[model samples]
Target: MSAPAPPSSSSSSSSSSGLVLQGADDVEDCVWENEGEGSLPWDRFGYVSDLVRNGNRAFRQHRLEFFEKAVSYYTRANQIKPNDPVILGNRCATYIRISQFLKLRSASDSEDRPLSGLDPTIHAELALKDAEKLVDIQCNSVRSFVLKASALLLLEKYDTARDTVISGLQVDPFSNSLQGALQQLEKIHASCTGSRSNTKPERTDDFDCTLCLKLLYEPITTPCGHSFCRSCLFQSMDRGNKCPLCRTVLFISPRTSAVSVTLNNIIQKNFPEEYAERKSEHDSLTNLGGDLMPLFVMDIVIPCQKYPLHIFEPRYRLMVRRIMEGNRRMGMVGIDPLTGSFAEFACEVEVTECEPLPDGRFFIEVEGRRRFRIIRSRDQDGYRVAEVEWVQDVEFPQGSRERVDLLELTSNVAEHASSWLTRARQAAQQDRAKYEKLLSLEHMMPTPRDPERFSFWLATLTKRRPDEKLDLLRMTDTRERISRGLIYLRAEEQGCRLQ
Candidate 1:
């Protein structure tokens, strides 16, 4: 085949391919010349040559549609001769051109008639994929590196694009295209950094999450292009799956979505003090100090007990969502019948499992952890939050007479409890589900070495009144708790109900 004619000035004026191949003056220069053409069957060679000619001609036309046509023709050529370096490179360049055109076109240009095709990002991503394959197949080609770097640049990956150009320069230190790309990348990067550094600090709604009315911390940008603090967005999303700003129906959840790192860095770097303050405020809620916790006002819970809770109220649903995001722990407290207020003592529970329903409710399983004595209480966003002191049994020194006696007492009580459960399991065997539940509870028993925890586990073997559980939470004497656990077991064995 004869060498294709050099591109003319007239063709350049009407060319769409020039958008991506701006450094190259002619399309013929972009295509490798006569490398493997002789090896191809004549009929297949003629057909591929025709396809390439048509693609080159289509891209030289002054229409985006024609640019797409060029890509389609190159794609067919590629399918016929898989891994043809020339065809891949041409198709990759065409995709980059389409992406660049779409991205640079003014909104006003398409305001009247929306362009019906893949968006800029998708095109750029396609270009990047092809460019990557070209790099893998033609590792030594400067053009492959240039194409990949260009696609990455259009995708806004400046650092990676800069690195790609640098690597290409290492391959051919005298290549002007790579040198120019390196310079262009440095200038763009410097300008972006300089612009951010030079801009005056301004406090505006632009940096605040609409949901929280505060400086955005760990901001997440939705697919709809709206940004919010990650926690604030999910809190609002817990109530409804819609962008709080534009109400665009959101398909992302906190579990799947990630913080917008660039936007977050911009905000944090620009407004350091405000960002720090916002972070501290957020930490206060999510990581309350050792003595403080958000409280769930419901039934009493004792340590070493496990149960499921249905969170339906808006306040508790909000609390559950936050807890799941944070440490997955909260205080479970009940009202004091005498004072008609939250009980002074409560148990801390960790959410072991959580399932958020579509209707803004949570089905959660929690395991009681430790006890706390509320030193002060307050309302937070319609739920109870308390400053408390963690409660634990007063321990006798190890190897002391008191500790030895306590351990012996615990072993005796454990034996009694085991025998009682065996009988209870036998009695409940007629009901398969009840027997299974007892078996599960039996498996959860703690060792007598952890007498305090074992006492609570024993107490759970039988259903107790709310006030009785409250008393258990308040007791700091492990031996006393164990004695009470034994009494409860015996009472149940004797068919006596404690009111």
Candidate 2:
């Protein structure tokens, strides 16, 4: 073999091919001279591959500079034979190493926690591009798919990463690498959703909230040297303005205090699995209704009336506490005396105010919002829960005779109710000293002009059997409720005259 000549100073030189060749001589010596031998591309590829192999060894030995040196050789080889899969794959592998090294180094770097110097995201993206090209070149290349998935995973494109792994598994069904990647993705999904994981528990105490003796969720701490789950503390404070453990008076309202940042971080970092489970559990309780609300079965609460409650039972206290923490709303179902469960129809109520008494009871005031018919019922935490679809007023067709008839009926009912109210007011006037409060009923009688409001208000004020009141509550048609109210008012008025 003839000795290779050193190039002139202005010509430049590249010794990556293991030969002293001028940059100007590279084209002629590589392609033209070695055309007959057909070893030019192979020689360049072999030389680059050797550099990449040595770079891999150096990477394992922590020789960081060798990555840059190997990249230079790979670039030269790629320029000589563009789009060569072997060269692209080797270059991509080197880039991946650089990204991994930077990421590992960044963990201890104070300037940035996950990245510094060269952004690993850029390298990972570049590796992804090369991996894509490789996959295009070799449709069934398992290595390319694995590499692409790894790069995507590093870039936090979890869905795409999982899909890529699945694609690889489709091509090579028994690949352990693909299986491992899929498992990692499942873990990530579980962590984000607060679902149970297959891994062992982190620590028992880390996951437990002191008040609930369950997993910590929306955890908060009090100034009285205590920490409890936010909902748990709120419930405790609702009963008595003191901490359950220390009985120290808590001046901070449950709504005002922020979540403990340090504790939240520790829980998220160390007990991700349990934290995910706890979050899922809380969501199931609070966000219960899409179309149906969780019902509180106890009384016959009519719409547009305030229902005051003294929550003392353990189950009911739990129910009210959940209501306060959630949307502050629940369905009020009357207990069916026949079946001992709950009536099929109920009115929804929203908590207007909640006063926590010192003995772990709640003085809660709720106002009715709407009515619903039970679709299903179950028991949860010792209280009856029902899934119910909201009952809206039946809208009569426009210009229909039904609407006109209902209007006429409502007017007649109102007149009779007014007459009953006038008679009651006169009776109270006959004894103003003893019946002072009944005087206000004269003015309040005509205030509820809305048929729905009027019907419910009449039910509350009128003396009626429980069954008859329940019948009014279950009535969806406002006209029917008003007709029943008219009958009740007429009967009462006749009784008053007889008395």
Candidate 3:
């Protein structure tokens, strides 16, 4: 056996130096042994650590006291670490986790539900916003991004989440967890889009396909118990990774035959009126020509994959509905603090599916195909109207489709990705069910142009100061992203450059 290597300088600031605390699952008693004195960076960390320790104990008894301790701990931590981005961010996290615990428990237990009259949806929305703020504050680490992304996902903010994660990786490309996460995001998008089946089954007019003008055949009823023709549901899953029907966990496989038949008949028979109402609601949301929006609201943006729109503000619901009325959708632009509070860069969203809720709200869905930047926004009476120009996709240089190999890079990153891909394909050949979920995971891999992998590899170049993570976050181009990765790969032990 070879001699043990020296510890990396980057890891010199080990919180528990004498004893190794490699992962979260390692419940070693000796962890605190080395953390005896002056180890923690801030007082809040110490306080939270104590709370976490006590919380663990309370959790053993499954007591309510445990969560309350955690809440108070985080609350105190947040108070001290207010302007500290990480602390502020983590405070948001603690609150979200707390709210989620309460929300989920409330969902399961009818009588035990709190009498506070707080809407879980509102609480969920707030939690997601806090996560978004952490991202805004640039305190979003890859791990924090993952956590925020989860909350956004739970809140059905799919486009917001995909955009956020992409931004995170641009900063710290060497994060394996983020890469794995982006992979998961892509699968979820695919699953959302995959709901559109080839054979349009008979149902209400709204469920019918626009392309073939036929009813959706091979109706896919997801685990959440919502059925759509296979095709329409495909990319929606990518946006949110949840069942489009009932917003539950959707596997990337087709439901059983018997189940499909049962769903089809049940939807047609028992839910026919409900389906028709939903369809009619969908048609009412469309705008064939001029905008029919309120004077106060300006533009409505249903965000898309690559659009740079900073969609915020609660009043935008009216804006979205107005856009739905005439334009069938509206432009979404990115917020530029220097230029304007509203979005300066944006894209047009073409409304595809609009499902109305019982409370008269619309579950409006749209797809973004291209990008545009608004040059000017003027008050059109009460509504906001803008002079906008298109941003061609061709303006951004894309790698040639000619076969390019990242074999050398893959050679270093443990081959976990490619090996999994191969196994997935093989599994597809053997068991269709297993293959789809595996394939779902595989499908999320970034295309060669995606700098995420390079970003992750670059992160390893040399663990610079924690400040370096910020520079990584701000990087905008692919070449730099890869260069950073290569620097680490070269500096890493005994690695070769394939390029």
Candidate maximizing lDDT? 1
List where candidate 3 sits over 4 angstroms from the true fold. 1-65, 76-81, 99-120, 198-499
lDDT of 3 by residue, 1-499 (tens): 1112222323311122211111111111111222433233343245445544453443233223343354444434333233334443443444444334433442234233322222233334444555666566555455457556655654445566667668778878877656655666676567554555456445466555443345544466554555665434532432444565556643232211112544544455545675476546444433423332222223322222211222233244345444543555665443433545664455466654443322223455454433455566665323466666554321233344421333344344434444634543564566644443333333333444434443433343234432343344334443555566556545533443211
| Tens-place lDDT digits, model 1, residues 1-499 | 1112223444432133222434422233233443553244454456567888889887777357777788877865654465677887877777776666665554445344435523565467667878888889888988888888878877767788889888888889998888877877787678666645577667789888887788888887776788888777756766777778888765445333345657776888889988889888877787877877999988888987887899988788778867765788999988887788889999999986454554556678899999999999888988988999988899999999999999999998888888877777677768755754665576577889999999899899878888899999989899999999888888887887521
lDDT of 2: 0.61
In model 1, how large is the Cα lDDT of residue 321? 69
- The parts of candidate 2 lying over 4 Å away from their true place are 1-215, 222-224, 233-280, 415-453, 496-499
Rank order (by TM-score, best first): 1, 2, 3
Which residue window of length 10 is worst by lDDT in model 1?
A: 1-10
Give each model's clash number: 0, 4, 49
Q: Each candidate's TM vs. the true structure?
A: 0.57, 0.48, 0.31
Model 2 worst lDDT run, 10 consecutive residues:
19-28
RMSD of candidates 1 onward, in order: 19.4, 27.9, 21.8
Q: Compare the candidates by TM-score and give the number of the best one.
A: 1
